[model samples]
Target chain A: MAKRSTVIAITVAAAVVIVGAVGAGVAVLGSRDTGGAAGAKGDTTVTVRVWDEQVASAYEQSFQAFEDKNPDIDVKLTVVPWADYWTKLRTDVAGKSAADIFWVNNSYFADYADNGDLLDIDKTLGSDAKSAWAPSVVKQFTRNGSLWGVPQLSDAGIAVYYNKALLKDAGIDPASLENLTWSPDASADTFVPVLQKLTKDAAGHTADDADFDPASVTQYGYNAGNDLQAIYINYIGSNGGTYQDGDRFTFANPKTVEAFQYLVDLMNTYHVAPSAADTNQNGDFSRDQFIQGKMALFQSGLYNLKNVADGADFDWGVASIPAGPEGRVSVTNGIVAAGNAATEHPEATKKVLEWMGSAEGNEFVGASGAAVPAVTDAQPVYRSYWENQGVDTSKFFDVLKNGTIPAPQGANFGAAFGAYGPILEDVFAGRVPVAEGLQKAQDAANAALDG
Target chain B: MKWTRTLLVYLVLLTGAALTLAPFVLSVMTAFKTPEQFARRSSLSWPDPVTLENFGVLLTGRTEFGRAIVITVLAALLLVAGQLLFSIMAAYAFARMRFPGRDALFWVYLSTLMIPAIVLVIPLYLMMAQLGLRNTFWGLVLPFAFASPYATFLLREYFRGIPQDLVDAARLDGANALDVLVEVVVPLSRPIIATVTLITVVSQWNSFLWPRVITTGNDWRPITVATASLQSQYNGNWTLVMAATTLAVVPLLALFLVFQKQIVRSIAITGFK
Candidate 1:
C-alpha cells in the first residue's frame, strides 16, 4: 500500500515536470513566431539608435520632420538609453548587426573610428557641411585625416553660474563679475577676500567677522567640488598646463601643481567654499545648493543653464571662469553623430548625417534648448532662444569664441577618465594631498594610454 | 531572558530584511516620479503627482515592459524544466542504476563545476553562432538549459539518501530502470527538486551578461536585460528607473511568495535547520 502511494506521488511529479516542459516549449515557439512576424517587413524601415529616452521622443518628432522633407525614407528611432548604449553598441558591432546611424561621444570616438567601426564621412560631406560646424568638432572626430562623424551638439567647460539674489545680499555687484581673473599666487589676495565677503553664517555674520565660525556658515562663497575632469582640466588649461606632451603625461609639472594648489586653497585655507567632507557627502551635484538659494556661485557647464532655469525659482546669471596665471580657458566637450560601419544601408545613413549637419536641422535641435548646436552659424539661434527664456546665453557663445579648450585627447581616454576620477575624489576629500593625487592620476593615465 | 532572546532574533531578522528590501522600496518610490524629481531628490519618497506616465511611455515601445515580463517568464519556465529534468535523470543514473564507471563519470561531471562560467562564454558563443542560433530564443536558452553540474550533484546526494529497499521492491516487481526511477526515486526527491527549481529559476531570471551578449534585440531579451536597458535610458531619472526595476522584480517576488511553502520545506529537508 505504501509502495503504491509512493508510485502515485512519483507519477504526479513526473506529470508536472512534463507539463512544465511542454508549456516552456510552447511559450518559446509562440514568442519567436510573433517576433518574426513583427520584423518580417524589413524594406521600408530605417532605425536610428539614440542613448536617451527623454530625448528619444523629441528625436522621433524631429525625424518626422525629416521624413516630411524626404518622404522616400521611413525612419524608426530607437532609444538604447545612455547606460546600456556602449555595451549594446559594442555587442551589435561585434555581431555586425548595429543600427544604421547612432550618436557617438568624443571619449569613445577614437576607438570606434580606429577599429573601422564608424563609416568615414569625408568623401560624402559637402564643403558647406565641412565649414559650417566648429573646427574643434571636426578635429576631434577626424582620424588619420578622415572625418568619421558629423558634429551634432557641442558643450564647453565650467562657467561660474551665480545666484543674483545671493550676490545682491552679500553686497556684491553682479555687474562687477566681468573679466574675472585668478592665478595661484594672486587668488588668495583677490578671490579669497571676495569669497570671505560673500560667505555668511546663519547668525548673519560674514566670514570676515571676528566672531565668525567656519563650520557654522549657512551659505558658501564659491562652489568647486564635483567632477575633477571639468574642474581640473579648466585649472590645468588656465595655468598653461597640458595633460600630454605628444603621448607622454605631463600633469606632474609645476603648472599642474599651481592648478592643484588653487583648488586646495578654495576648500582648506579660504573657508569660503564648502568643506571637503560636505562635497564628498554630496558628490557632483553640490552645485544644486547654489541654485536652491544657499551658495553664491557654482561652476558647471552652460548646458546646466536649462536645468537651473527650469528647477530654480531664484534669479541666476552666468560669468566667465576665473582666469589663472597663463590666461582664461574652458574645456570643450560635444556629441557626434556617426554611421555604423556594419550598417546595410550606408547610403541612407549618409543622408541622415547630411540632414543633421545642415543649418536648418542644427538650428531646429538648438532651438529646442536642450543642447548648443555644433554649427558656428546656428549658435545665435540657441543664444536668442535662451535669452528669450530669461537667461543671458551671450557668455555661452563668448566662451566658445575666446576660451574653449578641447578636453585631453588620448588613446585610452575612457579608461583614464574612469581610473583617475575616484583618485581625484580622494584628493578633494583631503584624504590624499593634491600633489600625491595628481601624481597617482598621471601614472594611471599613462598606463591607460600605453594600453 | 526569553523576551530578550526573541527581541534579538527579531532585530537580526528585521535588519536583514530591511537591508534586502530598502533598494527595492526606493526603486518603487522613484518609478512614479518625473525626471526633475528623480534628479533633484535621490531619496525614497513618493512622487508629488504619482504619475503613470513612465509606464505609459514604456508600454508604447516595441520592447515594452509587458513584453519583457512575458519573455522572462518563458525563460524561467524553460530553465526550471530543463534543469529539473536533466538533473533528476543524471542523478537517478548515478544514484541507483548499476553501470560501469558510473562513479567516475559522476565525479567528472562534478569536476566541471570548477570551470568558471567566464571561461566557457567565448566558446559557447562561438558554438551558438556556428549553430545559427545567435540572436534567437534558442541561442539564449539552449546553452544554459541542461548545463548545471552543481544541480545534478545536489540531486544525486538527495537521491542517494532515499532507502534502497523501495528501489529493489520496484525492480523486483518487473519494473525497468526508467519505471523504478519514476515509481520510487522521484517521489522521495521532492525536497531537493523544489530547491533546485527555485535556484535555477532565480539564477536564470536574474542573469545579465549572458543574455545581454546572446540576445541582439529586445525581442529575445529577458527581464534583467530589459530592466538594465531601461535603467540606462533613464539614468538621470532614478524615479522612472526605480519604477521599471519594481516592475522587473514583481514576477520573482510573486514566484517566491507562491512557492514559499515548498521552498521552506525543501530547505528544512536539506538539513539547513
Candidate 2:
C-alpha cells in the first residue's frame, strides 16, 4: 500500500511538470504565430529611435503632424533610455534590424557612418541639407565632405546658471557675473575673488574671511570639476587650448594645463567648489547641489535648463561663462537623426526624415520647450516659449557667435573616455600633478584611438 | 554564556537584515512622497503629506507601467511553466533513467552556467531577428523559456538523493518509470521544486537587459525596462522611480509571503542556509 502511494506521488509530480511545459509551450507558440503575422498590414511603419524621453514625447507630436500630411506613412517612436541606447543601437545595427531613423550624437555617429550603416544625407536631401540646418550642427555631422544625418537638436552654448539670492547676499552684482574673467595668474583674475565672496562657511563667514572653515562650507561658490562639456572643455577652449585635434587629446598644451591648474585650485586651494572626492564619482553632484540651493554658481549648458526651472525654489538667472585670457569659448554639441542604409521602406523613411528637418514639423519641439530645435527658423519658437516662462535664453545663443570649441569627435570616443577618466580623476583629487596627468591622459587617449 | 552567543548572532543578523532591507524601505517611503517633499526633505524622513500622485502618474499617465506589468507577469508565468516542465523531465532522466553518456551530458550542459548572458545576447538577438521575432512577445520569452542549466542541475541533484528502494518497490508493483517518478520522487522533492519555482519566477520578473534589447517601443516592454525609462540622464525623478519600483516589487513580495514556509523548508532540507 505504501509503495502504491509513493508511485502515485512520483507520477503526479511528473504529470504536473509535463502538463505545465506543454501548456506553456503551446500558449507561447500560439501567441508567436499571431504576433509574427501582425506586421506589415496597413501603413508602412517608419520607426524613429531616440534616447531622450522628453524629446521623444515632442517628436511624437511632430510625427503626428507628419503622419497627417503623409497619410500612407505611419511613424513609430521608440524611446530607449540613454544608458542602454548606444548598446542596443550597436547590436541592432549589427543585426541589420536598426530603426528606419535613429538619433546619433557626434561622438558615436562617425563609426556608424564609417561602417556604412547610415544613409548619405547629401545624396538623399541635396543642398537644402546644408542650407536649412544650423551651421555648427551641420559641420559636426559632416565627415570626409559627406553629411550623415539631419540636424535634430543643438546644445547651443555652455553658460553659468546662478542662484540670484546667493549673489545678492554676497554683495556681488549679478551683472558683474556676465563679464568675470580668470587667468592662470591671480593678479588679474576677477573670477576667483567673486567665488571667494560667494562661498560661505556654516558660521556665515565667506571663503575670504580669516575665520572661514574649509571643511564645513555651507554654500559652494562654483562648480569646477571633471565635467567635460560644462566645465573643463569650456575652460580649456577659453584658455586657447584644444581638447582634441582631429580625434587626438591635446590637453598637454600650456594653455590647457593652466586651465586645469585654475580649476583644481578652486576646489582644493580656494575651497570654493565641492571636493573632487565627491564630484569625481557623481556627474550630477553640482547640478543637484544647485537645485538644492547649496550652490551659488552652476556652470552648465541648456541641458539642465528644465531641471533648474522645475527644481529650484529661489530666483535664478543665466549668465555667460567666465572669460579666460582668450575669451569665453563654449563647446557646443548637437544630436542628428540619421537614416538607416538598410531600411526596407526607404521612400517613406526619407519623407519622415525630410519632415523632421522642416521648420513646420520641427517647431513642435520648440513649442513644447523640449529642446532647442536644430533648424534655425524653429529656434525662435524655443526662445519665445522660455520668454513666456520668465527666463531669458539668449545667453546660450549669444555666446555661440564666438566660435565653438568643437565637441569631442571620433568613433572611439567612448573607449578613449574610459582610458582617460580615471587618470583625470586622480589629477582632480590632487594625487597627480596637472602637467604629468595631462601628458598621461593624452597618451592614453591616443593609444585607445590607435587600438 | 549561551545567551551571549545567541545575542551576538541576533545582532549580526539584525544588522544584515537592516542593510538588505534599507533600500526597499526607502523606496516605499519615497513612493508615498510628493515630488516637492522628496526634493526638500531628508531622504530618510517620512512623507508629511503621503500622496499617491507618483503611482497615479506611473499607472495612468503616459508611462504605460500598467501594460508593462501585465506583459512582465505573463512572460514570467510562461517562462516559469516551461522551465519547470523541461527541467524536471531532463533531471529525472539524468537521475533515474539508464542512458549512455547521461552524467557526461549533464555536466557538459551544466558547464554553460559559467558563461555570461551578455556574451550570448548578440548571437541570440541575431537568431531571434532571423526568426522574425524581434519586438514580439516570443522574442521576449523564447530565449529563456526552455530548460536553464542551473535549474536542471539543481533538480537533478535533488532527484538523485531520493531513496532508490521506493523506486524499486514501485517498479515491483508493475509501475512504469513515469509512474515511479510521479508517485515517489516528485512527492518527496516538493520543497526543492517550490524553491526552484520561486527562484525562476523572481529572476524572470526582475529581468532587464534581455527585455531592453529584444523589445522596442511600448508593445512588449517589461516592467524593469519601463521603470528605467521614467528617469532620463538630466532628470533623476527619484519619487517617480521609487513609485515604479514599489509597484514592481509588491507582486514579488506577495509571492514570497504566500510561499514563505515552502522556501524555508527547502532551505532547511537542502542545508543551503
Candidate 3:
C-alpha cells in the first residue's frame, strides 16, 4: 500500500510537470499549427547547411553581406558535424526537408545528382561560372554534361608539417627536409637515414645506432597512420599508383602494393612511425600526437594548418611532401554546395546558389583561413590568411600548379572504400602482410564496384 | 575472517564505483580547466585555479543550450506523463476488464518491442514529414508521447496482482469503473506507476537519434542533440563538451533526487533492477 501511494505521488508529479511545461512551451514557442512547409517565405528564409562550424561562421559573414545587398532573402546557416552530416543529409534530401543550399563534396554529389535530388548548377549559373572556378573542382562536380555542385573550397593536398625545433635538435636543417624520399625496395636510402637521425631510443641512441631499441623509443620520426586523405593517397599517388580507372577501383597496381608495404614497414620494420594498433582507432590521434610535439615530420594537408597553428607550443612550418621515386605528388580535393531540387523557391535558391559560387561569397571562407576557396580569384586570400598566421602557404598553391592528383573519382568510390577500409587497417597494423591484404582488398573493392 | 570478508566486499564495490565515477569526475574537472592548462597537465591532475569559461560559453547563449534544455524538459515531462496515464488505463482494461481478444491485442502490441528502433527511423521520419511536423516542437515530442508496449505490459502484470475483493468493495459501493480506477486501482499501484514513470523519463530524456533526425535548427533541438553539436563544433574540446554535458545532466540528477523515496518504494514493491 505504501509502495502504491508513493507511486501515485510520483505519477501525479509527472502529470503536473508535463502539464506545466506544455503550458509554458505553448506560451513561449507560440501556440500555433506549424504544419505548413518549413523555411517557407515570410520574407524568404533560405536555409544554408554546412558541416564545419568555423566554415559556417565564414558563411554567416558572407551571407550577411549577401543579405545586406539583396535585403530580400534571409539566410540561416546550420552546421552539422562531419560524422552526422551525410546521414542527416540523405534523409533530409529524401524527405524534401534539406536546406535550400547544402555542402556536398565530389565523392557524395554523384548519388544526389544521379537520383535527381540536386539542382544542376549549370542550369542556374550557366557556363560563365565554370571558367572562373578551378578546373579540377569544376570537373569533379560536372556529371552527364551537367554541373551538380558549385565549387566552394579545395584542399591544398598532403604536405609535411615538420616541427622546426625537433628538426633542429636532430641536427637536420628545416630547408633540407624536402629532399627526403622513400622507395618500395626497403634498402637504406636518404629517407631511412633521415628517420634514423630523427628517431631516438630511450637510451639516447639514434636509430642509426645498432643498439637502438625500437620498443623503448619515446618519440617518433614520422606520423605514418592510416589517414586515407593525407598519408596513403599521397604515397600511392607519388609512387604513380592508380586506385581508380574512371568508375572502377583498380588498386591491384604494383606501385600501390609497394607503397602499402613501405607504409607498413615504417611502423613494423624501421619503427620510424607510430604503430597502427594505437593510431588507427582514432583518425585524429596521429594529428593530436603531432600537435603535442611528440612526432617530427607530420605530412598532412592545409586542413590541419589551423589545428597545428593554435595547438603547437613550438615553432612549426610546412614543406612539400617528400619526393617519392616518381617525384613528389599531392592529392587535391574540393568541397561544393548543392542546391536542393525540391526546394519550394527555385528562383531564390538559384540566387543563393549563385552567391555561393561567386568570389564575393567563397572569399569569406578563404579570408577566414578556414578553407582554400575553389573560386580561382579567392585562392590569394587563403594564402595570405595563412601567411599572416606565420606559415608560408605558397607551397600549397605550388603543389596545385605542379602535379596535384585529384582524389579517386567515381560514383561507387564510397561503396568500394566501405568494403575494403577495415581490411587495409589490418595491413597497416601488420596483422596481415601488405601484399596479401591488398590482394584481398582489391577483390572486395572490385566486387563492391561491380554492384 | 568476518572482517576480511567485509573488507573484500567493500574493496570490490568501491573499485566498481570508482570505475563508473572516474569518467564523470574527470569530465567535471576538465570542464573547469582552461585549454592551456588541460593541454599541459595530466587528465587526473586537479585544476589549480578552477574556471567556468566552458560553462560561460555553453550557457551564455553561444550554443542555444538554454533553449535546448527547456525543450528537452518539456519533451520528457510530456512523454513520461502521457506514457504513465495511458499505460495505467490500458493495463487496467487488460488486467480486470473482460474485453474480447484483449490478450491477443496486448500480445501483438508487446511483440513490437522485438523490432529495433533504427528500423522505424526512416518510416517515422517520412510519416512525420508527411504530416508537415518536421522541425516543429510537436514533431520532437509527438513520436514519444504515447503508452509504450513495455510499460503497458509491466503495468498489466502489476495491476493483476491487486486483490479483487478491494476492487469489489468499491464497485459494490456504486462506484463506476472510472471511479474505481481513479480512486482504488491507481492509489494501490503507486510503486509500478513510479517505476514506469522513471523508465519513460530516462528513455525520453536520452533519446538522440529520432530528435536529431526530426529537428533541423535549434528551435526544436533537445539536450542530447545540442551536446553532440558541441563535440563537433568545438573540435572535440573535452572541457567545453564536459561543461555542456554537466549542464544537460543536472536536471535528470535533480529529478532523481526529488523522487528518491518513491523510487525506493517502487524498487521494494516491484523488485525491479
Candidate 4:
C-alpha cells in the first residue's frame, strides 16, 4: 500500500514538472511580440529578403540612397542563400511568418503567383511602373492580369564564349564570322565543316584534311554537351517549337525533334563537338575549360562573363548565337522581387516593392555587373559597366533585341525540368533516339503538369 | 612470413584510411585556397596561397553560419538529455520490473521499430501543429527525443546482462526501485551508457531532414541546413564551402578523438566486438 502511494506521488510530480516546463516554454515564446511590425503606423521600416549575396551589397547601397530621398521610410535587408531561399520562404509562408519582401525566380514565379502566395502589386504600381520593364518580363510576373512580382535582373542564352587569341592563332577572323546567320540545322552542313577546318590535330592534320584522325583530335570545335536549356532551347525556339501550348507542355513537336537530332549529329555524325563520354569525364558544367584555355568554345550566360573576366588570362568576347529557321532565338530568364502575402506589414512591404521597382534600384543592379538589369532604362548603365571592365557587352543587347525568346514556363515546370536531365543523358549516350527521348520528356512533363 | 603479413595489413589499413580521409582532407585544403587557386588547380592539390577568408566569412555574425552552430549545439544537447533519461527509465522497467503482460507490452513497443521514420513524419507534424509546437525548439527535439524502440531495446538487453545480485542487495537494504536504479544498476551500467551516449550524440548531431522540415527560419536552423545553404550559394566558390564544411565536422572528430578509449571499452562490454 505504501509502495503504491509512493508510485502515485512520483507520477504526479513528473506530470507537474512536465506541465511546468511546457507552460514556461509557452510563456517565454508568447511574451515576444512576433506581430510588432504589423501594428506600426505611417512611415515604417520594411525588410526585403534576397538570395544573391553578391548583388545584396549593391542593393543595400542603393536602398540607402532611396532612404536618403524618402526619409519617412527605412529599409532592412535579409539575405538568404540561393539553395535554402525557396524552402525557407515556403515554410515561412505556411507558418504565416514570412519576410515583408523576398526574391523569386522565373522557374518558381508561376507557382508562387498562381497559388496566391504573392501580393497583387498591379493595383498598387499602376501602368507607369508596368511600362518600365520588358514585355516578356512583365508577362512572367503577371497571373490572371495581376502583377505578382517585380523583375530585378534578366539573362539570355548565347553562343559558346571563345578566346579571341585562340581564334586569331588559328587564322580565324572574328569580324568576318557571321554570328547571326548560322543555324543549328546548318550546324551539320556548314558550321561543322568550318569547325573542322579550324580544328587541328597534334600531328599537324586539320580535322577537314584527308587522313585526319577524328578519334585523336586533341581539341573539339564546340561544347554542345551542356544543359539543354542552355543550348537546346535556342535550337528548339528557332525551329518554332513551343515549350508550352496553353497549359500543356509540347516539346515533342517535329521542330523540337529536328533540333534534338541536330545536336546529336554535331557529336555523332559531324564529330565537330566533343563526345558525350569525353564531356562526362571532364564534368557536367565545364565552362571553366574555355576560361582556362583548354577548350576553344564554352556555352554559358553573361553571369559567367564576370567569372571568366576575372579568371581568364586571355582576351574573350561574347557573340550573338547562330540564327535558325525561325530567326535568332535565345532563352530569356530573370529574378523577380516579390512580397509574401502572409506578411504582417503589407503597406510597408508595398513601399519596399515600389523602391525595388524604381530607376535607382535598377541602376544599382546594373552597375554591380552581377546581372543585366530587368529595366529597359537601366540596360545602358549595365552595358557601360561591363564595357568599362573591358568586356564587350554589346552581344547581350543584340541577343535581347534580335535573339530573345520566352523561356519555358508551365505548371509543374520544375518537376518537368528535373526529368529532362536524365532523358538528355540517354539521348547523348546514343541509348535512345531523339524522338523516343523527347516523347518521354513530354510524357513526364505532362504528368508533372497534371500533378 | 609474419613481417610480410604485417606489411600487407599495414598497406591495406593505410589504403583504407587514405580512401576514408581523402574527401575530408581535400575539403580542408580547399577551404584555405583562394577562389582563383580553386578555379585553376585540381581539387586534390594544396592551395598556392592559403588564406582564412572563408573561415572569416563563416564566423561573421552577419552570416547564418554562427547562428547555425548555436542551434545545432543546443538541439544536440536537448536531444541527448531527453533521449538518455527516457530511454534509461523505460529500459530499466523492461529489463528489471515485473508487471501483468510485460512481455506483450515490450513486444508492442519494439514493433514500432519496424515502421520507417518517413511514414511517421506527416502524422507527427500534424500532432506538433495541433499542440502549437511548430517552429519551436521543443518541436524539433521532442518527437525525436523520446525513448526510441531500438535504443530502448538495446539498453534493455544490456541492462539484463547486468548482475541481478547487486540490484537484489540494494532492494533488501530497504532501497526503492528508483534508488536501486540510481545507486547500483546505473554504476554497473556505465559502459553501456557511454556507448548509448556516443551513438545518441553522433546521430542527433548529424540529423538533417527532420530538423530541416521542422524549423522555419535561421532561428532554429541546424549546421546541416547551413552547410547545404553554403554549398548552394558558393556552388562556384568551393573553397569557402569546403572551409565551412571542415569547421562544421571538426567537433564530431574531436569528440571521437577524446572518447575513443571509453567508446572501445563500451563496445566490448556491449558484446559488439
Once superposed on the true structure, which residue ranges of model 4 sit more than 4 Å away at CA? A1-49, A60-98, A156-159, A178-181, A184-189, A197-218, A274-284, B1-3, B130-134, B270-272
Per-residue lDDT tens digits for candidate 2, residues A1-451, read 5666665577567658655664565465445323244244566888899988788778888887787787777787778888778878887898788999999999989989999999999999886666989999999999988999999899999999999999998888899887799999889899998999999999999999999999999899999998998999999988999888988889799899999999999999999999999899888788888888889999999898988887788999999999888888999999999999999999999999899999988888888787999999889999999999999999998898876799998888888998999999999999999999999999998899898
Please estimate how well model 3 matches the true structure, expressed as its whole-model Cα lDDT. 0.80
Candidate 4 residues B120-206, lDDT tens each?
887887788778887677788889777878678888998898888888887888888887776677777777788888888888878
Model 2, stretches more than 4 Å misplaced? A1-42, B1-13, B116-119
Over the stretch B69-178, how does candidate 3's per-residue lDDT look in tens digits? 88887787788778877888998999999979989998999999999999998888788899999888788878778888889998999889889998999889877777
Q: Write the per-residue lDDT of candidate 3 for residues A237-256, one digit (tens) a residue.
A: 87888766776666678899
* TM-score of candidate 1 relative to the true fold: 0.85
List A-chain TM-scores for all predictions.
Answer: 0.86, 0.92, 0.91, 0.84
Weakest ten-residue segment in model 2 chain B by summed lDDT: B34-43
Query: Is 1 or 2 the stronger prediction by lDDT?
Result: 2
Specify the poorest-scoring 10-residue window by lDDT in model 4 chain A: A30-39
List ranges where model 3 is wrong by over 4 Å. A1-20, A23-42, A186-188, B36-41, B60-62
Docking quality band of candidate 3, CAPRI definitions: acceptable
Residue B105, candidate 4: Cα error in Å is: 2.5
lDDT by residue for model 4 (A101-167), tens:
8888777777778877888778666756878886668876676878778888877456557778767
RMSD of 3: 3.6
| lDDT of residue A204 for candidate 4 | 59
What is the fnat of candidate 1?
0.23
